[model samples]
Target: MEERKDINRLKVVLAEKKRTNKWLAETLGKDQATVSKWCTNTSQPSLEMLMRIAEALEVDMKDLLWPLKQQ
Candidate 1:
């Protein structure tokens, strides 16, 4: 499978938004463990989930992918 840029970028944006994993999970209607996995770069959110996260963070999806630009 192709790697996802959203993993680490989501973690950073979540931090900048002052959102905890538990808060993000609740906002996303997901389990905290799943949010934790996303934060730790151990897993990725689906496209639908990524859209939700982008909305929750009040950012465009491109912002999440921006962090990967130099890589």
Candidate 2:
């Protein structure tokens, strides 16, 4: 079975919101380096964390996720 890797749209959302990585890091009480990883798609936040991020950014969770391609 092939593993599917979903793209993370964190950086785009942050850009649209005019939010900096530092701001998100501080808001989430996480390290700036950690948030940087998320922005670069080098790592991902958990679903719960994503929820908090969406709330903090005033956006829907779906807005932080890349659209899946139609198979």
Candidate 3:
């Protein structure tokens, strides 16, 4: 089993919501490039940003960071 931190909940949440980078950016009042980075895991959001993200996505903050078993 290969476990890597690259597996993030952001991508899954975005996909489940059918949200695009542009949509997330507009909702978060951020740049699309920044949202793109977040989705691609190139950068991580700050705690404050994560709170906003959880709210915007209608998910609990814990859900946004819930780790999975290594696979």
- Superposed Cα deviation of residue 41, candidate 1 (Å): 1.0
- What value of lDDT does candidate 1 attain over all alpha carbons? 0.82
| Candidate 1 structure, TM-score to reference | 0.79
Clashes of 3: 0
For residues 1-71, could you state the per-residue lDDT of candidate 3 as single tens digits? 98557635888888888987789899988999998888778888999999999999998887778755689
Clashing pairs in 3: none
Measured with C-alpha atoms, the lDDT of residue 4 in candidate 1 is: 51
* Local error of candidate 2 at residue 48 (angstroms): 0.4
Q: What is the C-alpha RMSD of each candidate to the true structure, in Å?
A: 4.0, 3.6, 3.5
Q: Which 10 successive residues of model 2 have the least lDDT summed? A: 3-12
RMSD of 1: 4.0
lDDT tens digits by residue: candidate 1, 12-62: 888888888898999988999998988887888888888888998999987
TM-score, each model?
A: 0.79, 0.83, 0.80
The number of residue pairs in model 2 that clash at the backbone is 0
lDDT of 2 by residue, 1-71 (tens): 99756567888889989999999999999999999988888889999999999999998898788754689
Backbone Cα, N, C clashes tallied per candidate? 0, 0, 0
